[model samples]
Every structure is written in structure tokens, then in C-alpha cells.
Target: MRMSMTDLEPSRVEPEERVVILDFGSQYGHLIARRVRELGVYSVVLPHHAPLAEILRHRPRGVILSGGPASVYEPGAPQCDPGLWQAGVPVLGICYGMQLMVHQLGGRVDRADHREYGPATLEVEEPGRLLAGLGPRVDVWMSHGDRVDALPPGFTVLARTAGSPYAAVEGGDGRWLGVQFHPEVAHTPRGREILANFLYRVCGCKGGWSMAEFVERAVPALRRQLAGARALCALSGGVDSAVAAALVHRAIGPRLICVFVDTGLLREGEVEEVRSIFTGLGMDLRVVDARDRFLAALDGLADPEAKRKAVGETFIRVFEEEARRLEAQVGAIPFLVQGTTYPDVIESGGGAAATIKSHHNVGGLPADLEFQLVEPLRDLFKDEVREVGRRLGLPPAIVDRQPFPGPGLAIRMIGPVTAERLQRLRACDRIVREEIRRAGLEDRLWQAFAVLTGTPTVGVMGDRRTYGEAVAVRAVTSDDGMTADWARLPYEVLDRIARRLANEVEGVNRVVYDVTSKPPATIEWE
Candidate 1:
């Protein structure tokens, strides 16, 4: 496939050198691309069994084999086309990818006597191209049952753990590298540095991928794709959808109609923000304040999953109505642009077809919907999306907005959904967001939102005993939503947020910060 014209621009990060991450049914496969992008190089993630010709067409500078839950010894384990290794691109095999590399290269692997599931220390015996500059011992996050027992020809074991002899290995020629642990996740100490070393030293890839280049390239392509057809985009006011809508408008001037739905569960001032952004962008926009419709549909829903399903279904219904209106007004509506990212596809269990979370556009579409979906950001990560936004001249506040759940505050309410509870949570969440922004930690924190726990306890307010709902503040730092760590917020910052929420927001007694990470706890309480 020929590279798109948009692909040939001087990005903040250069696109000349790129990495292709081949997904092998791993949950964290997309994270690999995200890590690489953070290093200033562009990357694309493809399915494990993607054709070698398809991969080579992009002309990637390097390749990464992601760790999957599959066992390489299994008869039907996911395998790449043999031609991939011969592409001459440097290959980095991770976990299951390492096992597959070993087995394919004539090495031996077997079920370990003891599975390594958590943090483990690895001793680097011989550091070379991959492990250069790293100390002799390093802590790594490991999650594997099968272990590499022997090295293949022309390969040397560079590092090892107590249970696995071939924890880390390198091809004698130094082009291929393998590690049994996942360096893409933060729980693995020095994970970012490990990935940085690979992109800079081993692959000789320069970190030149930037969002500006994406916008310069993508806008024109989008115009071409939507030529003479009416494109409708679902605007959620969040950064992803906002950026997506902005890019679409840039692509097809006045041909894109942005539909903003007031789901009734959004944060404070969200609807106004959406309107301001769309109007400011000079987009052909329609604001549908269907707060009552959404709230009625979500009435009596207590389960978080059920709430999501209800909201998603209702959104499709509203979208379909708008699409019908557009068809009657404009005579034709053929495309529905979405803000779906690479992580959404992977978490939906790429290839294996496991549904992690149903995106409103992906799984929430009604059967009777007529528009074909157009997802431009499907191949890009969140950070890349932000870059594209910056390139498109979006304001910094809108471009760097934190990740919000699709169901909005509906899912943040721990107990039954009520207008009062929603309002309270919104107020509390606003305070937290304001404090973080004031502290200049907004960009560093992935998401920082307040959850309303219906369970209330007694507290003293001005010497008078009172009982109210307890709010919990969840602030996490993450590359992709798959794995995350709680942000180690400064004590003063946390204190400021808590004090403001308790004093300003009514009906809240206590405030707490979530210390848990992704493994034990997801970003959202519900």
C-alpha cells in the first residue's frame, strides 16, 4: 500500500523511522505502540497473523512481538507469517513473543515448574545491544507460565531469573531481542527506559512522530474519503471526540455535521464546552440537549454495566434519529465518524473477538443504522490524538482533557442513579479537576475524577454532626487505559483538592484518593 500524502510530513516527532507492533492476542499489545510513540517515534499495531506483505508495505524500521496469553507450545497458538522475520527489520519479542521466537528459531521451551506472576528481579549476565547501560540487576514485572529452556542457534542468553533461564536473549547478530517480562507496563520498573533504549539504540529509529504531521496529512485524506457525502460525527465533548470532530471539519469543510448529545450524565459545564468548541471551530454543528431522554432511559438502573448498556443503546437511538433528520435535510448521509482508538480495538480482544468494553460506536450501533463508520483515529493512541488536536490548532484545555468514561457520571455513582447524586459527583469531580489544573498536573495525570459512594458516615461540619455521601478521588497515570498506576500526587495538591471539595461541594463528608493500580482496580470504580 502506498503511504498516504498525510503520512509524508515533518511531525513534531519524525515519521521517517517507524515501528510496527504485531499483536499476538496480547492484552497489552496496543501499549507497546503507545510506549514507542512516547519516545517520539510513530508505530502501528497489527493483528498477529497479519500478512508479511501488508506489514512490509508500511516499511517499518523495527518490529515488536507483543506478549499474549497464548502458549507457543500449543498446537493452535497464534503465529506470524514466516516472512515477517525475513523483512530485515529489527524484531523485539516480548513474553509469549519471546517464547514463539525461541521455538521458531530452534530453541526449546516448556511449562515452568513455578509460574512468575508479579514483580521479579532479573540478573543481567551479559548486557549487549538491548541491555546496554542498564545495571547488572533490575526489577521487572513478569506474567508467564511457559519458560524458554534453551536458546536457538546464534542466540545468547543475556539475562535470567530464578525460574527461567532464558528470561532475556539476543540473536548473535544483534538484530533480534527477546524478554520474558513485559516492559510496556509501568509495574515493571524501568519499563519506559527499556523501550526507549530499543527505539533509539537497537533500531536506530529517531523519535520524530508528532501530532502536527498527522493533522497535516490526515485532514486532506479525510476530505478525499468523504467527498460529496454527508458525514455525521458523534461529539462527546471529551478530548477524543472533540479532536475527531475538529479533524473531520478540517477535512471536509462545511460537509461535516457534528451532533452533540447531552447524555444528562456528563460533568459540569460539559454541554457548554461542547457548544463552544464546535462553534469556535466553525463546524456545521447541531446541539441536541436530550438530557431528559437519556435520564429517563437510565432510570432505575443500579448496575454499572447495565447503565452503560442502557446509555449506549439510547445514544444509538438518538444518533439514528439525527441521521434520519440529516438524510431528509441534506438528501444523503453515508458516514458516521467515531473516535475509536487502537486500545479500544485491542481491549475488545483483537482477533480473538473478546469484548472488554463496548464502545458506543462499535457495539452500541443499532441494527437499523444506515451510515458506514469512519474511524480516523483507530490506528492512533490517545497521545497521538492529542498531537493531532494540537496540530489542528485546538486550544490546550480541550486538547489535553482527561479520559472520561462513556457513561459519564452515571457510572461514577456507586449506588442507584439519581439526579441529586449525579449533581453531587459532578461538583466534586469539578473541584478535583480544577485543583489538578491549577497545580499544573493536569497533563501528567491520565484521569482524575470523583466517585460518589452512596454509603455515608457521620461527620462534623462547623460543630454540628452531619451525615453525607463519601467521595473518592481517583487519579491515575497511564499510557493506555489497559494498565495504569495511581499518580503519586503531592500532599499539598491532594490537600487542596480535598479541602475545596469538602468545603465547596455540598453533601460530601469524606474524601479519599485511590492508591490501587490496574491489576487490582480499574480507573473507574464501577
Candidate 2:
């Protein structure tokens, strides 16, 4: 739990040195911010209509306007602060953003005769500050229905494609730039370079921000906030919660109590595994067997969000009861520590990010919860958290553990959660995990688990045919949990998993592999 002073002093950057991304509800808005951080500069995503003063309060080095689904001429299309141009900061606009900027700056933008939807050849006519270093001819990804027809007072074309006359343009003082293509997507080969030019060449950023700097700032901040007070941590044995507990343990030492809730939704042997790991680290670990309570809370719930909220509410009640019991021994425990990551915050409807799903730790918590949450890793991605864990001196086994959702198998099951179904799914999950690791892919893949699809399938185990439940196996590869692709697991690995599920796991007569990725289907079945 103790960290060396050397690990705590890495020459951090001030939080004010960052780029502010004005989100126009583009699916790529969060990705834009991720790419900016990948370039070693901090960035944040705000709603398009954020107050001019609020956007400037960050002392942003630059501003980026994200593309949206709406057209610029639409009745109620999102708009940014007109004062942004007068803020004297560099700004880059993309897609619909470009059209909006052009329209608001006294330029004309109209629907194109033929909208560009995919790959296009960019013929760089000028290669101004934003497009500099990219070759004269580059392949870019474009998706838009409108194009700029006329230039604003001080604007000129920088590049053009077959579909649009002004694919890229620069205006007034070289501080305003616009591109009709999305630079944050992987489809654009040199997109990262374009973003780098804006961050470094245009905004003049120092590129000093990093995960190491984040840890240095967070440790002291947690200490100052929880000084002379006790905190309880929800230690779920996953990297997020484990790392969160480790950081809090470093800050408050023995005053930090780690609670492991056995909600009966966990995979087989997981409870034992967690107990061994943290207890060996000398943590103040306590286990609560709230299996019956969680099941009762989720008895009739078949909807994913409802089950999540039920489990979330049930979890808080258990923690509050435990907190009261511990008060007599430790005086008081007012804070609940969680390993909530950036993806969790955004997906839970934080700020301009859409609410894709309500994460158990983020959106699932009860409104009247007693403890204030201390989330040290709230703004970091999954990969960044592993780096922080390594910096905190945690072992590789804990640092590199694949992600597990907070709602656990409850979310993995496709229907009503029952004791029979829970055990069957747990066994199936163990087989999948075992086969994956036996193939030496446990570390290679982001997550590999089993889902109990409530639908039954006809199968034959002996001389006669039998109908039993089908189990779906899911495995994905991802850098951050925000985006993922179906892992191309070896056929042999897949075969072993399927065979084990059918032969060893009772009630699972058929097995299937899930090939859907994150965009269309999340990592978890729910």
C-alpha cells in the first residue's frame, strides 16, 4: 500500500494545459478526445452549446468542433459560442462542424449534389498549417451531405476532393481550420498526424501530460480529501477496483477498508481468487455473502437497465448496512471508493457523452446512497489504468487482468436470473476461461467469457434427442473498453471451448461463438 516518493514526483503538467473538444453529438467525439490524449496532451469533451466562459475556463490551448448527424441549415442544429472565434485560440472543425463554422462565419454551405460517404483521395492544394506534412495526395475518410461553396472573408481552400471543392480550408490568422473528413477514425491513414499538427504546430502545446503525471496528482489529491477520515472500497478483484483500492490504500493506509461483495453473480472460484490476492497484499479485506439479496432484487427483471439498477440499489443497501456495523469498530466510514474508468463515466451520460448503458458503479448507484465516491481512475482509460497499476508496483497478474463488468454474470445472462441458470452459466464461463488460457490467449485477448442465451436448442447427448439451453461464447480485443473488435481466436481454441461447454456444463447442450463487435454489440451480451 505504501508508494515511494520517487514514484510520486514525475514532473506533472498543470491541468489547465489541455484542448477542449465541443461535441456536436458525433460518435467520434470521444474518440477525438482519446486521440488528443494519445498525443501526450490533455483534452476534454464538452457539449456544443457549453458557455463561452466555461470553455475558456480550461485555458485551452486549442478547440475542436466534432461532426454530428445534423446539417448546418437544420432548424435546431447544435451551435457553439460565437465568442469562440474572438477567444484568440486555435480551432479545427470537422464534417458538419466545418459546415456550421463556414455558415456562421459569413460563408455559404449547401447540400452537395452527391454526398461523400467513404474513402476519398485528398489533393492537397496548399497544405497549410493543419494539413502540413501530409503528402499532396492522401486517402481520407469522409462522411457528409454538405460542402462549402464560398469562402468567408479571410478563408481560402487548402485541399479538395472529387466530391467537394473545399475539402480542407483555412481562414483568418491561420488559427481557424476546417476539414470535411473525420480525422479521428482509423480509416484515415494520416489522421493522427493531422491532429498532431493542430496540437503542436497550431496550438503550441508542450505535450507533457501522461498517465504517470495523472498518478502523481491523484495520490496527493486523494490524501488531502480523505485526511483523518476512513473510506470503504468495493474491491471486485478486477483491475479497476483493485487499482482503485491500491491508490486509496496508499493514501489512507489502514484507514482504508476493502469490502468484497459476493453477490452470487461472479464466475466460479472468483471469490476465492479475490480473497487470496488482496489478503496476501495485507489489505483489510472483508467478504459479504449477499447472494440471496441480489437474486431477490433481480428476481423478475429481464430488461438489462432494470436489472442493473436493481443490483445497484441492492449493492448500496448492503454497503450501508456494513458501514453501520463497522462504525462501532472504526468510528466512521463516509466514502465509497470505486474503480470507475472514463468509458464508464461517458457511457453513464456524463457531460456531452451519450448514455449507451448505465454502468453499475457510475449510473447504477442509488440516489440516496450514504457514501461519497472517491474515483481516482475516473478519467483514465483501461490501458492507462494498467499503466497506473504498474507505476503503483502492483504485480503483473493483477495489473493485466482482463476487464469484468460490475454487474458480473447477471448482465451476461440473457433472461431472468435464477439459481439453476446462474450455476449453469458459471460453469460454462469457467470452461471458456480455462480453454482460452490453455491456448495461451488469456493475456492476448481483452476478455473471453460465456453467456447463457435463454433460448433452447435441440441436441443429442445419447441415443435420444434432448432440448437444452444454448450458451454463447464472447471474446474481444480492445485497447480501451470504449471500442472493441471480436477477437479472431484460433479455431482450435474455439473448438475446445465449445466442446467443454457441451460435455462438462449441464443444461448447455449447444454452444455458439459471438462475433459481434462493440459498435453493434457490446462486449457483454447485455
Give the Cα-based TM-score of candidate 2 against the true structure.
0.95
lDDT values of the candidates?
0.80, 0.87
Q: What's the residue-level lDDT of 301 in candidate 2? A: 92
Provide the global lDDT of candidate 2 against the true structure: 0.87
lDDT of 1 by residue, 1-526 (tens): 1232233321122256778888887665777777787788888777888899988877888889988888888899988877776778888999999898988888988999999999988899998878878899989999999998888999998999887788889994888899999998778878888888888888897676667666766777777777778788888877788888888887787788999888889888888877886798788879887889988988887877677778877886787789887787887776777787766656545554356666555555555555566778877778778888888888987887788877788888886787888788888988998888899998898998888877787889999998987889899998667778899999999999888888988888788888999866767887
The numbered model that scores best in lDDT is 2
Query: Which candidate leads in TM-score?
Result: 2
Q: Mind giving the per-residue lDDT tens digits that candidate 2 earns over 1-526?
A: 2232233221122475899999897655778888999999998778999999999888899999999988888899889999998989999998888888899999998889997999999999999888899889989999998889998999999999999899999996899999999999899989999999999999999897888888777878888878779989988899999999998898789999999999999988999999998999889999999999999999999999998888888887898899999999989887888888878878888776578889988778766667767778877778888988988888888999888889989999998999999999888888888888888888889998989889989999987798999999999998887788999999988888888888888887888888998887778878
List candidate 2 stretches off by more than 4 Å: 1-14
List, in order, the clash count of every candidate structure. Answer: 8, 0
